[model samples]
Target: GGIITQTPKFLIGQEGQKLTLKCQQNFNHDTMYWYRQDSGKGLRLIYYSITENDLQKGDLSEGYDASREKKSSFSLTVTSAQKNEMAVFLCASSIRWGRGAETLYFGSGTRLTVL
Candidate 1:
């Protein structure tokens, strides 16, 4: 019934360059999150926002920045790209965040490649 859209499905960046990714959801969910996925590292939470204009950093938020400009959109930026690295960035939304209260709907994801 709802969909999450992540823009620029593929990204190519140079080392040390800053790259940005974006997400938009039509579910009107109360919470939105950004996650980074790597081959062996699993999914790591990068940032989350409980509501518009509210930001919360996660374990991997150090090298990233996030913004919830509107309830329907969220954006993430990689402060410094790593050379020859590749990863997938995922965007998700939920009615409310909790251990077992709700399910997270994910976007197709944005794939990043650094040269």
Candidate 2:
């Protein structure tokens, strides 16, 4: 079995500050992703990388940036946190998809709040 770990279970930042989050997975999967979940917005993708050094922008990448520095590690940075913003950042990995969306395993999650 494999596991995913995320650092800093809670993150608090000032408005307009750049905040970074890190994730590591032992699944050895080929694809890793970062998504943001708001109170009612469901899950919105921020970025994904199919392999090491590869980067793909998702539906909600406007204010975020991500990196796949290695096969088992992925990180995300909020360029500028908004005032009173709050969301859960989820990190996930998959075994790669041949056609449709593949099943992804996620970390516990990192909660972020901007004051």
Candidate 3:
């Protein structure tokens, strides 16, 4: 069994400030991803890394940055926090097999609030 751990379970930021969220997984998976969740909406991929030191931008990566310095960890940063906004950042991992089935294992998440 494995688990994903996210640090700073809650984050508070001021408008225009930069905020960072971190994630670590013991799943020994080959791929790691960061997602953003808005209230009442589905998860949107922000960034993903297929392997260490590799990064790929997703649909919502415009206002964010991500890094995979190690195989078991991934980090994300919000370029500029918006005022009075709230969102959840989720970290997930999956095994890559050519072009086959993959299941995402998600972390509890880091909730962000901007003032």
Q: What's the distance in Å from true for residue 112, model 2?
A: 0.3
Candidate 2 residue spans exceeding 4 A from truth: 99-101
Each model's TM-score?
0.94, 0.95, 0.94
Candidate that beats the other on TM-score, 2 or 3, i.e. the better one: 2
Global lDDT for candidate 3? Answer: 0.92
List, residue by residue over 40-104, the lDDT tens digit for candidate 1: 88899999999898999999998899989999999999999999879999999999868774699
The local distance difference test score of model 2 is 0.94
Worst 10 residues of 3 by lDDT: 94-103
Candidate lDDT scores, in order, read: 0.94, 0.94, 0.92
Tens-place lDDT per residue, model 3, 3-49, is: 99998899999999999899999989989999989989999999999
Off by over 4 Å in 1: 98-101
For model 3, the stretches where C-alpha displacement exceeds 4 angstroms are 97-101
lDDT of 2 at 64: 93
Query: How does model 1 score by TM-score?
Result: 0.94
Per-candidate clashes, comma-separated: 0, 0, 0
Q: What C-alpha RMSD separates each model from the true structure?
A: 1.3, 1.4, 1.3
Model 3 residue 20 lDDT score: 88
lDDT accuracy of residue 67 in candidate 2: 84
Question: What tens-digit string does per-residue lDDT give for candidate 2 at 10-61?
Answer: 9999999999999999988999999999987789999999989899999999
